[model samples]
Target chain A: MNQIDGKSARALLLILSTFTYLLFGAMVFDKLESEEDTRVRDEIERITDRLKNKYNFSERDMHLFEAIAIKSIPQQAGYQWQFAGAFYFATVVITTVGYGHSAPSTSAGKLFCMVFALFGIPMGLVMFQSIGERVNTFIAYSLHKFRDSLHQQGFTCLQEVTPTHLLMVSLSIGFMVIVSGTYMFHTIEKWSIFDAYYFCMITFSTIGFGDLVPLQQADALQAKPLYVFATIMFILVGLAVFSACVNLLVLGFMASNADEVTAANREPPSAIVLERFARNSLVESQLFNIQKHSTVGVLPGRPRRMYSIVPNSAGDVHLRRRSTRRSIQDTVCCGCFKPRPPRYRFSLTRRPTNISHLVDLELY
Target chain B: MNQIDGKSARALLLILSTFTYLLFGAMVFDKLESEEDTRVRDEIERITDRLKNKYNFSERDMHLFEAIAIKSIPQQAGYQWQFAGAFYFATVVITTVGYGHSAPSTSAGKLFCMVFALFGIPMGLVMFQSIGERVNTFIAYSLHKFRDSLHQQGFTCLQEVTPTHLLMVSLSIGFMVIVSGTYMFHTIEKWSIFDAYYFCMITFSTIGFGDLVPLQQADALQAKPLYVFATIMFILVGLAVFSACVNLLVLGFMASNADEVTAANREPPSAIVLERFARNSLVESQLFNIQKHSTVGVLPGRPRRMYSIVPNSAGDVHLRRRSTRRSIQDTVCCGCFKPRPPRYRFSLTRRPTNISHLVDLELY
Candidate 1:
């Protein structure tokens, strides 16, 4: 496609996709609202009728059921905003900080939560995978350059220069920073060390459990903007440090196998190759033994071939020769093996040559 | 290490790690409690003292703040649990069907919510990665066996069997199951379709948002066991289907090149060969051209080897060549690129014979 056409098509596709999502979302919302309103009205009417027929219920009991029913309304909404928020929430939950103040308690709510997470978690994964791909590529490039620099300095492996030692050093610095920051926040906010660290952990994780918010009233009144700015800066810096550590760890592993694979498209060979090799070795040994035992009974029509030479075996030479003849005609080598050339006179003569002689012959 | 000794060491290491985590967690909890208690007492004292001095506040407004503050205290106490639940809640929230009647609203609570999520997401990722690794290995093994069976029936590549097609088929079945299950739950619980779907989403996601709980008065009076059994079955089935989809999707992606690099490691070819090939390719490329009148020349044996390559427009070519060369060297050739030997070679001959009496000679 032409560039202009391609650009327009892409733009159109983006708009269309977004619109489709929004349209479906709206439909779901409408359905939810209509259905929920009907259910609520019916429920209220039934409760009212019961109250009229039976002895008057206490205000507390009435309030309890109302609270329960009131809690039920959100689940019926099925709005897109709620789903997006929930999707973000699940990523937080599995990590186990357990900021429990917010949760679905109703059966329907819990059930919906489980269902939404099942799909959303995987979708979140796909997003993370895409991000990881980019991050890995950047790291791989940096490591490659680092390796080249190390090689120029006469180092064989990056690890030999103690990359892990450097990593530990960096981590120590990071740990100190986190501790100091926590300590400062503790003093300023009048929080205990545990609370400060907890705040740090929660803030860093982005789970925001919110069980212990820093409510520095005096500081807030005096410098609200400054307080907010510091918090943001602390979070950003913390995230950067954390990301760096992760990158280093990843790079360390990659550096060990740096020469073999790129950050992208590295695949290990199948285990089947090793399995087949072992199986074939066993089968070949058995065949050799059988041939050795049966060789003396062979008829005169079939002449023994001189090609087969089974190494590390107890088989007779005559049997080996006969088996070689049969194998030459019947067997097909598989996986990393090719059939030997037909018994050519030239090859037979060349086979016994030493390594130096072969090199000399090739060069000449 | 001896096998038994190695196993014991591993067990010890695992226990140590767990202990360390618990100790760190307890320390954080202790700090949180002390800090929170101090802040609450101070706040309550300041508020009451203000009320004693200022115009009298109504009982309801006074009660509201007290309730809010009291409610906020439980949030801090259940900090870890709430954090976990919130994380679960987030999963449900983002997936839609919010079941929002339950949420973390306190400043401390919201702060924890944000902080917990950031770290928890990555932890969740690590968990998923471990699970994915096992699942991928199992699926690969199964696929290999399946292919072998098909090979006996003479099929290759499951030709025309696209991964996308398989994904669609799996998703179709999954969607149907979800829809039917939701519909059935709606009928049984006398809930609206939206609520049922919401429940399904929450349950699948494992969010347990807890807004619209299932309440069966008849079941409570009768077969409570049966009701519990049905709930368990629902969950198990949902999990099975979810896991099946995940496994299938992962396997399908794995059948292609994208899955290769992410697989476990194997040794690759030596680096020297790749470097040499890359150097050769760079010199031979068309972009290596340099004019005699230009500041830099492209002739061999230049002192500015590094400088010449610095502004090199052939950067992409260099990278591609390096990566490709590395991959090729690492992989076994398997005769994929074996050069064809010359079919014929002429021998120079001096002859006194007539043109009619020609001689032919072969040279190896």
Candidate 2:
């Protein structure tokens, strides 16, 4: 899709999805406002009040309880504001932004959310996936020169690196950035070390739980602009760094077999490997000899060769082949080497030259 | 990790994560209880009250406003219950339950949430991945004998089969089970189709948003036994079906190339396929050439060979591979035997040879 069309489609989807959520939210509000809901609420309040009076709740306790009760009620607001918040929340939740401020309470609400998430999460994933792919392409393109420079410097196996290593590298850079940024944020916002670290963690993760938001409170009035600017820059830079890390990690994971290739090139199989093959062959041959004279009736013949042992100086190791014919065993192991002890043996009418006969050998 | 250890670790993580959230909740609640917090609350309330009075909100409007306001409040109980609810919310949000009954209002809350999700989501993913691996190993072991029985009857490409198809097969069986079970739930719960579907979706997704929780609101006489039975069955069958689907999906995504051993098994490359390969090769060559040249410039002289191709067919197609020691150019022909002009030339150097370049190539 063209950028405009793609964006419009996204907008439309967002609108429709938000509308659906609001419709549900409205329904829920209506339901809770009903006589039955009111009765339940009243009963719960009464029970809680009795408990409070009996126990003598502190002023702090009363305030906390009252705050929760107040927050539980849905607000009447303009569709624009409510929808904006809801859509934003939806985006945050699916994107893993989570901003734990708002969440479902009723079992039915939670249930619906789970249902919404099944499709919504995947859709969100596709969005991130698309962005990630493009970002990766760009990074690969830009890093091409840098990598080439490194190549000239005799850096081999650059492409064969592990995700963990790449993650560590990126994380080191990210850690430095976070620490420096957190320190700066602390100076600007004057939050404790734990709070600053916590804020950083929450922001980068996109949890946005809202409990510890920056630049929202009234205290840091003088540094508001600086704090806001820093917050934005931190998020932008942090995201870019994070995205780069993700790209590297993904590429590293996808290139997991690179090490195998390097190993293969470094060391070719030795003649000793061949000798081990031959020893395995001798074992199979002796088992086959015993199977030929077995008393049990022969099983139906397979159409394809089940196993092949190429004679080498080391010994013979069985190589199982894919079966093309119907009724042929997909497994190609010799009967003699079967892990299980055989109680009966199949007596073939003819001694088959093909590897299929390997299956007829029985274990005592 | 041992099963017991694994279980306990998971439990501990869950508890710790929940506790951390609870601590945050209490802190926020404490803040909101302070004189300053109360002032902010009053300001917001005044603004909302003005909006409500000026708009002359209807009863429905009043309900919506009340709901939103209730959700906007920070805390409603002691640390224990607040922790319990927050823990449940965290689980629901991560699991995608999203009941929507409670959500964030403040910017700080929303922002903090985003940060929380970044780490939590990935952690959850790792946990799920490990669990999935174990479950797959177990399933594979158990199915080994049954699969052998089928193989004895002669089945091919079973290993190469896609997981999507397997999922389809599983879903067919799962559908029947769900249909019968949902019907029973409907009979027992007397919910409408929308509510029933909603319930099923929520339960299956494990969001359990709780807005429409089952059995909790049922008549006291029937609630005890029925609720217990439903809960047990839901947990048991829900996990089974979920694991099965995950197993099948993983199987489907695994590479089938490793299983195909035939020398003549090479499939003809589709046009799109060839184009992608060519693009990837060009990029790789460019990168390699750039790196080599840069290295050679620094080293003064280095023996390198460039694998290059020139277009044989009519058109502007040219293929070139250049290295410090040698360069090769060959004629390139497009699938339709048409030639195209070169768009741009850029080189990458120091690229990892073992890296599977094709993964970066987009087939779509």
Candidate 3:
């Protein structure tokens, strides 16, 4: 496949997989967990019966009493693959947050979880990475363009002030997300802003301490699905902005060292042509798209040089120039490029820059 | 820093960080939670007094009576970061488990968590990866040596059978951890083995449900510190073996294709000198102390060309033969090899095998 086409499809695959995954997970979890769910409900009702007799509460009032008391039940708690619960489960699984508030109780559910995680975790990562790049490229391009626009308007300090400016903007934006979410959670959960802030921080980091879960209010059970939906939006946006901040951090680090890299190698851009050999859609940006809709081009022959941008350590852009001879060997005979002894090769390419990457690069 | 030395130091750092982090976390949590602990005790006493007045339960039976009634009190739940609780909190924070069964309720605690995570998460990952590599390399070398011993005994099929054999052995070893853990948990918690199995799976995956935590007996809280210590050991070993499996999978996949790779590249082994240029101790492996003890040598002139081993997108090991001219440039002029346009570069390295890496490399 043309790498660009392949890259573009990968992002779509993330969405497609999520929908199909959710559909199947919901069905399977409901199936596997229903028996256990029924037992839990039965036990709760039986206890309610005993409590009503002991406390002299009415049958209708007994349910309210059980709903309140059921929280004390050590085992067989609720949220067993009910739609809200299942959706919540799926979110945590894909995000790899795995709060364990609820889990697959049956063998079948366990098998399904193993199978689901095998694919879903990678799928989620790809989606996060792709969207993160788009977000980063958007920010980088915007900041660059903003700087250019300012320069055009005779504001000349952008060259010196740009990194700090970008960081400030990114930090403020990330904090805004925290503040806004804190307010919403504060109002809804009647938690103090401190509690809300703590929750947001825990969540966006994907630590997902189940202690501060939503749908806790007695009144919210009827609107459980809506709550899940809101929670989803809350998490996704938080993740995106959080990822953007991380990207900005990387760029900031790189820009800080940009002077050193540029100063060290003013030797007319080496004839060496480093290509980003990654599966990520960042290579799709080889044919730059300003947005998903608007396609643009780097001047035909002088396409901009890209190094590995995303940090997950999977689709690192290979900086080694594919020599023409190697390119031919790559096409006519495929294995030459695939089996180069990487152990020795990394040692051979021991420049200071590569060494820096060794530290900065996440092995994932 | 030499890559081998760096990698070697990393494992030690993990242990060191855990101790320092635990010491600080324990101190902080104990300080923060002591106030709340007293409040909870007071509330429990007051509630016991109310129940004692209403139901004529004896003062000697206060704890048993409240153990039943204590379930009703919503505020001031258990798991306060006393020495035991604090230790658990530190484990979750470093591991990114964040079970939230017991989070810091105080503002100081919350702030500390964020700061702690900012450093600890990355620290933990580095340690996991380093330890995982050491574990993998040890296993691989041992298995290889084992196979050689079998061959010395005149076994012919050893080469063909080794990879699969190693996998089976590794798998059995991993399963053994689970079974032993299940047994211990079942006996301790008086849960069925099936429930124990569920807890182990949940805990190892870092999902940490908090639903079936250990040492729940009224007699056990007095030994809560001991229980916490046991839980830490269980989690650490589980994480270590689990990580080792993941690393092995990467090697296993690459080794699976070893035949195809060797068959495809039959040209005289190019004079490719592969030096492991890690900031890790893997290059220290070049000075092999088989299992962190004895030292060895890299044959001075004839270096083995290594290939890309781990498929994680970041820091992919590239197998390239360093040509004489490039070697000079690499040594004399450090920057010449570093500057390459990344955009057109990925497109330039198109080959069928490379495309497969795009898919197969990310099985993680």
Second chain TM-score per prediction? 0.32, 0.36, 0.50
lDDT score at residue B338, model 1, on the 0-100 scale: 21
TM-score of chain A of each: 0.31, 0.36, 0.49
Model 1 residue A144 lDDT score? 42
- Model 3 TM-score, 2 decimals: 0.52
Report the lDDT tens digits of candidate 3 across residue range A273-309.
0111111222454322111001010111211122221
Residue B52 displacement in candidate 3 (angstroms): 18
Candidate lDDT scores, in order, read 0.38, 0.38, 0.45
Query: Per-residue lDDT tens digits of candidate 2, residues B1-364?
Result: 4322443354355435433433333333333323333354456577556544654546664554344335322222111112223333344334333433344333443443444455445444333333333333333333434444666789743432222333455566556656755776677667765566656654554434344544433332233555545544553354445645553443222211111111011121121112112222132444432322222121111213212212221011112212212221111111101121111011112222322241233311
Better of 2 and 3 by TM-score: 3
> Where is model 1 more than 4 Å wrong at Cα?
A1-58, A61-191, A199-364, B1-61, B64-160, B180-192, B199-336, B339-364
Q: What is the DockQ of each candidate?
A: 0.04, 0.04, 0.07
When 1 and 3 are scored with DockQ, the better candidate is 3
Give interface RMSD for all predictions.
18.5, 23.4, 22.1
Candidate 3 wrong stretches, greater than 4 Å: A1-80, A100-115, A160-172, A219-221, A224-227, A243-364, B1-80, B160-172, B219-221, B224-227, B247-364
TM-score per prediction, in order, is 0.37, 0.37, 0.52
Better of 1 and 2 by DockQ: 1
